[model samples]
Target chain A: MPKSVTLKDVAAKVGVTSAAASMALSGHERISEKTRAAVKQAAEDLGYVPSSAGRALRSQRADAVALVVPNSSAHVFGHLYFMHVLTGMSTAANAHDAQVIVSTNADTSNGGVAYERVMRSRTADGAIVTSAAIDDHHVEGLVASGLPVVLIGNYPHLADAVSVGIDDVAATEQLVEHLVTEHGRRRLLHVSGTLDHQTGIDRRDGFLRAAEMHGLTDVAVIEGDLAEESGAAAVEQVLRERTGDERFPFDGIVFANDDMAVGGLAVLRRAGVSVPGDVAVVGFDDFGFARVTTPGITTIRVPAEEMGRIATERLFDLVDQRPGGRAHTELGVEVVLRGSCGCDPERAAAPGPTHSH
Target chain B: MPKSVTLKDVAAKVGVTSAAASMALSGHERISEKTRAAVKQAAEDLGYVPSSAGRALRSQRADAVALVVPNSSAHVFGHLYFMHVLTGMSTAANAHDAQVIVSTNADTSNGGVAYERVMRSRTADGAIVTSAAIDDHHVEGLVASGLPVVLIGNYPHLADAVSVGIDDVAATEQLVEHLVTEHGRRRLLHVSGTLDHQTGIDRRDGFLRAAEMHGLTDVAVIEGDLAEESGAAAVEQVLRERTGDERFPFDGIVFANDDMAVGGLAVLRRAGVSVPGDVAVVGFDDFGFARVTTPGITTIRVPAEEMGRIATERLFDLVDQRPGGRAHTELGVEVVLRGSCGCDPERAAAPGPTHSH
Candidate 1:
């Protein structure tokens, strides 16, 4: 095989040291603009693209980010949440001329050992941790190890870690407020996600705070694992108990996420409960089908994709040793009103020809 | 930095040449078992992990696979199909002691140039192309360049290419036959995905052939973009046309995928059409929400994850120059019966509590 041109050739052509050529080619601030231009032109002229070894040796970068996602059996691969995040992360990486290396774990206990090896072997420069569970010790270890890490979700305990997350607490509070104020909803039920993760806890906290603010004594909370099965099961128990004004009359239900909300809506529909007319329902993380579903689900449109994009960009800034300005960013969310909520049925889409029955 | 230990240090300690040490470390067949063990022990003893540069220079392999998914607006991130496939692909790579580098493209016109650099720079060893579009000329260019390539979906014209895909034709055919034999439905409407993709063409062909076999002349077809919105619009238009025995007694609707099917179900329910009663409905690619949806969507369960896993493994086999037994793998799909189909409403979950209105 013919010998390929290398950094040495470019250096020689530009009459500079190999280190100078590398720095200039990499656009180092220390290198003069004149030298940078000269090195780049010479590299192009000589067709001196860095081989894997040359690139690895010269830049000392993998140009890759490891995205560690939660591997829940039901939600991880089935729900649109992670998919949207991954897509956004991938898009951001692509735009930045980097690629994403994805790894899935229910809890990231083994993250450190695995990610340490990843960094040591030059498989990736840094990692973006998507799961910000309450008991995520491995994340603390990753931060302690001084490896550039960016958390995709909020971790209350690890306040110092770099992160980009949604305003889960405020968003949920807003949804609850929407139900209480405009809809005149007093007795309520919050179908919450598990308390294991920061999102669930924060959202539930938001619900309780909102409930207290409304001074509603007749309120209840049911824990769901953020899956449709959990939501259906929870609602089934409610039906079996013969829910009505005789007991804790829940005028409205607030779901921690859209998945559970959709399930709740279906269960309520089957039971002959009229949505909005009887029990108002509102959801979080306005999933893709939210806009199109029957009764037109009222929801909070979480910036899942934006979170992924920002987290990725933050990871790159950390990996490249640049000051990324903010260490934490809490993106804003929007409240979308529809037929599911009693506030405004006008915002819902026309049921059209299929509304006959 | 305390001069981190290198391959040279390991070799010196093991009393072997650097080449021998590298071969032993990499588990090359040329290296004896004793040499491999000794090199490994000495490297461990000295804590001599190859730095990023050294690993690249010695192994000459990135040990990563690039997964290029379709960057469609609606389905790519929102649907379960892509997420499940990605999760499985990532898992397969992890099992093989490799990592997955993800990319997205609607059309792969720019793939060759990007992937050409990816390989040349040792960013990834091979790529798995998920799109099997009829006009996928970049795939042809990739094949011509002798790069290790694996297509996740089937393309009939590319007979020489390696691929792993579902038996789309048989799966769709079986679905249509079920609608006829079990439901005893003569008039039908097949909602098809876009014809630009091989999947769409084959599925549409399957529906047509099944109709021909049944000798049903009252069947009609509606074109969709494999999106919920597409399915909703098509069904809406049908409803507006006053669909009945007058125009064409369409008793069942076969959706190309679950997203569209879910959309169709909502439109029908709104219009007072009872599923599997007034008109049966069946969907393809049993998505996550299929089981929980009211009336339970009857659909085909495509091995999306398996396809991704198999395609990844095949790409690695080709990259490692191993003779993978089969050049193509068409995984079998199963027909799932539920309340939406005429066969076995018992199979549907007791959508208890929420069937009232």
Candidate 2:
């Protein structure tokens, strides 16, 4: 198909100039009817497909997929969650016979030159965007440009955007229910991450709603950044409140994320507080460390890797022009029950002589 | 400089064919003496650098650095250590205004078409290879092709290779000393990764050497495939031997990597073995999880990120034609004392109710 037919081939068969034959075959009005008919017949006889279209389908493709993390490289690289996400993408991409190129979006600070060039580079078939950052403009811009994009976050405003994510609110609600029902905790404290991010808002709201529904009389919420230090500090604040007021009762604490949970556990340990026996603790984000931290942290597994795989598959569907390519996918999160929520005392980790690495 | 002086400028001034002017300026004898002299004088007067040479440094460049992980993509994306390495590369690449392209050498299975194309693709100026796989031919091929290359592991066979890595043997020796002198652990067992890889070989040799030097009578080495399951099975074997003979006494165990160590810890826990009380365990590779594990896994930090950064810097040196690009660099490792080594009995982890995630 590539070398068998050319303009010259048709022109030679038609006994006309290559330029004239090209124009005639393309139905240019300037060419004589006889000449145009002859050129068209010659083209059909030679089984010619347009070079531009053929190249667009084959030679022009970069055969690479872009994984866009719309956050700082530090954020993406530091968290194993994102690494797991990348792992899934790599696996799916490998199956599709394509290499995935990571776009950390640090270059967005440089007028988004890198992503803009990615749009232009025909080698990159499409992009899977992890819109972890607040700014949606970068993602919106890509969608606006009609580039095939599958986002790994919930963006309600971008109604047409294809997305894959878990229902953070529901997941948090289930976690709170576990505390109230399974652990039989009446007094509860929900320590939330920064409310600026969507995840923080969803989980916080979920916690409050769950507390109200359960008809728990002793419950409170505290605002803190998602840093582990914040978790430790929040725990101290709780202890101080309980000591001073004598009415501030709390038996179970829920950390916004596992990092914070780890910190809170450290503080609880130093203070000689018996976990589950005195104050039950639970965390979110089932990171690898969450499971191994003494009494394993019963947290919400965000399906981060699965999100990556599904998003990539959806993006490829769009790239491949398949049906339902732009469908919104809502993945479910699992409540990984562990010792933190006082599930099973028998599985509690044996004491070791060290607290942290 | 880009727009001010071009080949056209020299061509217009010299009043000769571009081919003739280009050849003359390059000292090609095909051009007549008068033409050559005129072209040379015009080039000098115009401060013109040959387009070919100038573009070789700028326009023809991909302006991206390739990170070649000569291992399966699963091996890389599955491990946070590799992610941290990528983070370091990303940070350094960002500083240099170059984006990093991760090449998970799985394509090498398909005849290395991807990396071979990377060599031909002018946009990728240089490559930093993590020679984790046993095949040195892939690395040697890149070196032989004259592409600027820096390795992140010791490659003694590639004499001219620039590399950055921690001394595994020395690190292991120090780790062994900690268990022997600091913790007073006499009978020991070393769980080594598969010997097919260099890391496994180095670490095993290090463990044997350290044992011989320390003069510990009860020392044994067990080989595994570097999987957590292998470590678990190894622990079970230790328990079985002890149960049957009543003489296979072991006070401490060293795992080749943290994943195995975590596994072994779990096995010990289920067997009702007391960590640091009955058996002190240690691991290599200070993965983030190493610190947070129940009794906290004592580990040797591999300096994965630092190695990435140094290797990248050295790669840029070769690409930029700077001095001393191909020098061997040995980075140091750190021994993190934790509960597993019984370093701080006062800091034993508070027991929890759950086990592995």
Candidate 3:
């Protein structure tokens, strides 16, 4: 096997100091273009790979970021919700010329171990955290360590931390209002994720606020794990228990996330319950499958990918020590009216041709 | 801001040689336990964060692997199937205490540029490649460069290259056989990815072989991009052009991948056609949302996560020059029988519980 080349080889080949070669290859502005080209060419010819650490030693930048999903490894892989979040984070991180280091634990209690390792080892210059709960200890730990951190979801207690997220309350309120006033959806059921999560809490709170404002008192709430099975089981429980006609039980169902919504949709369809014509439904996070399902879901487009991009850019700015930066950033959400919500009457009459994107 | 601590600082504080401190901290067998404890305590006191690249240099290991999806960056983010593959790969990579650097281009043609950059710079010690076509130039380049490379899918031309993938032919045959024997379906339609890809070619060949074996002559084929919309539109074209009494009209559809299958399912449902009863369907890749849809798709489950794990480990072995290793590895596939194929007659009879994995 051929021996690996080193920076000294590139420098000797280019007739320059090793430090000069390193600086030139790293795109330092102090180096002339001719010298940079010569060094790069020599390095390429010799297959002299510059180590990220060597570059960091000179530039004081790791050029890599960490994306922390505060969930167990099992949960991360099993849940579709995390997949969407990961897609957004990875795409954005790659766009910024940075790689993402995912941190997860084997056990739920060891969630902080991954972060501690990243921190004490300085494995990443900055971190983008998703699904941050209020008063999150991990967020606090990251802040205390002085690492640049950005949150993808809201954490009310971390008022001084940079965060990027959608307005969960307003988004859910708009969804509920549309179903109640526009679609005449009485007897509403709000299928929520674990209330421990800020997103679930805020969304459920918004739904209740909208319900109270509209004088719709017959609201039933069910808690789920923000997974498809949870949504299906929650709805099943509601169906098996509901008793009187006067209760006007659940003419509409709203899920906190798309995975749950898809699950709920399947359960409703399986129960021979007509969607929209009977119980209209809406879901959060306009995930890819939302359009592919039958009677396509009415969902709030959370701009998850966009939020990820902006959050990463902000974290980069922090890592670079930019001044006058604010602590939080919020992206907008739009309600995508689809067949399930009954807001699109024409959809029921003449459904659009199903196509893949 | 606090200045980052270095190994030299730890050594100085601990009154040890830099080499002794390094060996001690790294847990080298040559170092005494007492010395190792002293070195470790100094490191913690001084906050000496070990650089991954520096460690890689001393150990002659990159401690990182690359999962090269040869498609463009735009294509990766725009498609959900890639997201699933990435999730699986990420989970596996993380479990092995390694980081995965995902690299893609803006166009498939530009795949070589990104790969060449990584290779010439040695950003990763080894790479697991997916999205390589049968005659992909990128694979050829990597082979010539003598890097540790693993192909996620089979490439018959590169018989020496290590690969971890399912038997596309056998999996496709099983899907066709299930539809024929179980559902009593006669007319079979195969929706495939680009013919240039081995997966598409193998799956198409398998479907044809099954049809021939079953004495069915009416086999129709549609070429799609393996996207949801493409699958839907492809089927829509077939449905629109078919004559009312055309002999052996397609009643069963086999898609090359799950995204396309989901799209085909939506298109069929939108056309007022009942799935399984009117047209049984099967998709490949058995991704997360496949089970959540009504009449959940019957598909082949590719062991994507396991494939990724084996691919990474094999690449590590190759880079590290482990002996007695072969060039290619092929994994297995399982047929996930679900509602879409009409295998579960009970599912069609009533709304069943949502499926979870």
Candidate 4:
């Protein structure tokens, strides 16, 4: 291997003292922007690769962050939407000159196996945990470990924990309102994710709240473990139990996420049920698949990438010991109109064609 | 924090010596399967948390692996198919009681910034690098770093490096044969991913070889950076450069991946072109979105998760210093027929609905 470049080399090239160079490289406000740029350029030109050991020793930081998702099911990890979050986190970490490491199934249910290893090894400076559940022992363990951590998605029980995400309850309420007022749908069936997840509980609560507010007496709920197969199975169960005038009891079905919605749509199609005409359907997380679906799925657009960025930014703040900024950062969500909700399906179905770079 | 359960505790619970417990936990052949199971059960029951520091000191291994992808564009990271690969790797790692850490942009083009940190910090026992380009300095640096690394996707130039993946050439040939023999597509336009990538080169070669075998003279190729936007833009360019009697020019178009294929399909729709009626379209990587597209894209189904599992298994083999197992492990691919490629539009368009937990 070539001789590793040093900070002194960068300082000499920039015609500045090592202290000045260090300040500039570190983005310390004491150094002028021009000096900082020059130092960074010089460092780049010199191929100044900082030794991880020396940097860790000097700053007592790993210069890396972990993005942990407590998913035991390999299928959940395959959710394309989380890829957007990963991209956002990676972008933010790259901007800060830090690395991002992703770990899945690092939950307390598994004895916090991955988390314990990461913390004990000091593999990362801080971590951003996503989709935290209510009364999650993993998050509690992370909190108790004295590691800088930030949670994405709301958890009222984790009120003291730093989090950055949207209000799932409000988003679902808005969706339900749209379904009720605009579409004139009274009998609704909610296909929910696992209650263990805070998202499922919050969305279900919002659905009930909206139903009560609209004075809708006929309402039903079905359990889906946030999987497409479960959604299809739920449809099968609903179909098997139908009687009288209403073959399908519900006029509208709201799914917890787009993945399950796709499955439900498929089941409906196989049964020769026209979307919106027979059963108006809506889903959360407007994934790429939503646009391509027949009639397009009306869904809630969560700012997944933005949430990831903000959560990472919060974790970095805690890692840097920045005070007063560790509170929950709640962003807003939008209800995307599409054909599945009896909207102008053509134009609304137009996918903005997501691009990543 | 509660005191971490030690080997002694597990040993006592299993009615064995601490040394025996350690040997069983470490998978020593001296221990019987029953003893190993008992020891593991005891450890789990006691919630034994292994100290990474102690494990590292004893085994000179991190008990973790890094799955790194060279993603310059933020969009590339969002390629939904990667989730399968990640799921596979994570599942395999979980089975081995090891951890999987995902990292991106660990390229030498960025002065090997991420790679240097990962290496210097010794964050993982080994790494599995995916979709490596032909002249990737980052991968070269990784190989030279003397780190036990496995490359996914082929790199003919890196003759000395260990790799595990499928035969991209054969897969592409199968796609082309299906297109020509079954669909009767003569004029073919291949929208290849960046030629700098081994996949692109190999696939392009297959297309040419298959066309030659069919005695076809009209064949063209276009460069795409594997992003959906690029595929859409390429469609626009082709339309702009079309001649008389052929507004679109090509009878069939094959995209490198599903993302680009989705983009191409959108452009085709905007142009009022009938898929398979005006021009047949096929894509690589049969992502879930492929089924939902209006015409349902015919695609090459690469066993992504299996590839991930095999590659990771290879990396672990090297990490364990096992000999005669560093061979290139190639899996098979299948062509999934759907509507876009001039097949049964109705039945093929039916999405069987993907499931995620």
lDDT values for all models: 0.75, 0.74, 0.74, 0.77
Give candidate 4 regions above 4 Å deviation: A1-61, A71-75, A95-98, A106-112, A144-146, A241-251, A345-357, B1-61, B71-74, B95-98, B106-111, B237-249, B324-327, B342-346, B349-357
Worst 10 residues of 4 chain B by lDDT: B348-357
Off by over 4 Å in 2: A1-60, A71-73, A113-125, A244-248, A320-323, A349-357, B1-58, B71-76, B113-117, B120-123, B244-248, B349-357
lDDT by residue (B291-356, candidate 2, tens digit) is 877677889988888888888888778777788733789988889987788875656644432212
lDDT of 1 by residue, B3-77 (tens): 346788899998999889988988999999999999999987775556755665656666778876544332555
**What lDDT score goes with residue A305 in model 1?**
82
Query: Per-candidate interface C-alpha RMSD?
Result: 5.5, 10.3, 7.1, 9.1
Please give, for residues A208-301, the per-residue lDDT of candidate 1 as tens digits. Answer: 9999998999888999988766777777778888645543257899988777877877777666676776788888887665665556678999
Local error of candidate 3 at residue A269 (angstroms): 3.1
Which CAPRI quality tier does the interface of model 2 achieve? incorrect
* Per-model TM values vs. the true structure: 0.83, 0.79, 0.90, 0.80
List the TM values for chain B, per candidate: 0.84, 0.79, 0.90, 0.83
Best by lDDT: 4
Instruction: Please identify model 1 stretches exceeding 4 Å from their true place.
Output: A1-50, A70-78, A105-112, A240-249, A266-278, A289-293, A343-357, B1-53, B70-78, B106-112, B239-249, B266-277, B342-357
Ranking by lDDT: 4, 1, 3, 2
Ranking by TM-score: 3, 1, 4, 2
Model 2 Cα lDDT, one tens digit per residue, A40-93: 888777755333222333344445577776653334355787777877787678
Give the per-residue Cα lDDT of candidate 4 at A225: 82
Clashing pairs in 3: A270-B351, A355-B229, A356-B228, A356-B229, A357-B229, B73-B105, B162-B327
Docking class of 1: acceptable
Per-residue accuracy of model 4 over B131-165 as CA lDDT, tens digit each: 76788776887787667888888877887788888
